[model samples]
Target: MSNRVVQGRMVTPGTLAELIEGSPVLETEDITDADRPCPECDGDVIEVGYMPSVTEFVTGYKCQDCDWSDDDRE
Candidate 1:
């Protein structure tokens, strides 16, 4: 898997997913560029799709330069 740098640290897909999820995940997709600016600092953003639990899927967004994160979860 291709690892990406976030907050100056290299992180794999699973690690990044956990970073955003605030816990371990069941599964994860490859990391991708979000093609969007960070809402907090205008930095570049990345995206990852993961299963936080068996019954839920979430598309998580996080900043590469700062502590900003969001997710598409209902």
Candidate 2:
């Protein structure tokens, strides 16, 4: 799992606990083999952690050279 910080604060602190306590545990199976391309640089998305808002899980990806993120997409 990956952790992200914005302005030195977590984007969604305690996201995992909220997911485990709210969403069904079985949902984890749905994303076990999924791979989403980076919306910015078309890099491989790496599993960061669970964030139901973005799928049942939210991922982060970076370009090897540019280090761009999905949010950084132009």
Candidate 3:
């Protein structure tokens, strides 16, 4: 699905990417379950691919239980 429950609110791929990127993105892909867990909380992690700019595409990861998040840019 393109939408997921993040912490408590329902968020789309764009929103999820924003949570990781710390800003709005230009484009986004569907949200998916990551094959890993949160580092801090050991919670379920979700993945989303987004384009922050015209030339950059990033894969973002977010914990469903807490504020922990990450990106492929690292």
Overall lDDT per candidate, in order of appearance: 0.94, 0.36, 0.93
User: Candidate 3, after superposition: displacement of residue 52 in Å?
Assistant: 0.5
lDDT for residue 37 in candidate 2, whole number 0-100: 64
Tens digits of lDDT, candidate 1, 6-31: 99999999999999999999999999
Single out the weakest 10-residue window by summed lDDT for candidate 3: 65-74
RMSD of 1: 1.0
The TM-score of candidate 2 is 0.26
lDDT of 3 by residue, 1-74 (tens): 98999999999888889999998999999999999989999999999999999999999999999999988885
TM-scores of the models, in the given order? 0.94, 0.26, 0.96
Clashing pairs in 2: none
Best by TM-score: 3
What's the CA error at residue 26 for candidate 2, in Å? Answer: 23
Residue 6 of model 3: what lDDT? 94
The alpha-carbon root-mean-square deviation between model 3 and the true structure, to one decimal in Å, is 0.7
Which residue runs does candidate 3 get wrong by more than 4 Å?
none
Q: Could you tell me which residue pairs clash in candidate 1? A: none
